[model samples]
Target: MTTRTILAAAALALVPALASAECGWEKRINANTCGEGQTFDTATGTCVDQSTS
Candidate 1:
């Protein structure tokens, strides 16, 4: 196959893997529930301890 065609196929193969990868914290809004001693940070969309954050 041509180089361009091979590159296109390789890129397509990476699409699924990239899609499944967790790029960042899961998106949540106003659902501030967190485990004991942890507080949900709205800016980062993650749970952090009160002392640390």
Candidate 2:
């Protein structure tokens, strides 16, 4: 494959990992105290009610 093609493939492979990393704080926060009826919101970096979220 061409260098550009290879680089594109590598970047695609990294997308999911990068996405998960972006939301890693959600996992950590939810693990601590998200509580029922609430979930971690990566955008706000805090727990929010499921209904509003």
Candidate 3:
């Protein structure tokens, strides 16, 4: 294949990957309902004290 054709194919292949890629940070608009001064811990899947965190 020609150099230009190879480059075009490579660019086309990357189009879907770039389009499907998730960009930007996720924001939590609402606060966690795990009581006062407590946050939800993903590791243990429970509310943990803020002091320890």
For candidate 3, the 10 contiguous residues with the lowest summed lDDT are: 22-31
So what's the TM-score on candidate 2? 0.46
TM-score per candidate: 0.44, 0.46, 0.42
lDDT of 3 by residue, 1-25 (tens): 9999999999999998877664434
List the candidates ranked by lDDT, beginning with the highest. 2, 1, 3
Task: Name every residue pair that clashes in candidate 3.
Answer: none
RMSD, every candidate, angstroms: 6.3, 7.9, 6.9
Please, what is the whole-model Cα lDDT of each candidate in the order they appear?
A: 0.78, 0.80, 0.73
Off by over 4 Å in 2: 26-53
After aligning candidate 1 to the native by TM-score, how far in Å is the CA of 38 from where it should be? 9.5
Arranged by TM-score, best first: 2, 1, 3
lDDT of 2 by residue, 1-53 (tens): 89999999999999999997887564455435888888788788789878862
Alpha carbon lDDT at 23, candidate 1? 52
Candidate 1's C-alpha runs over 4 A off are 23-33, 36-53
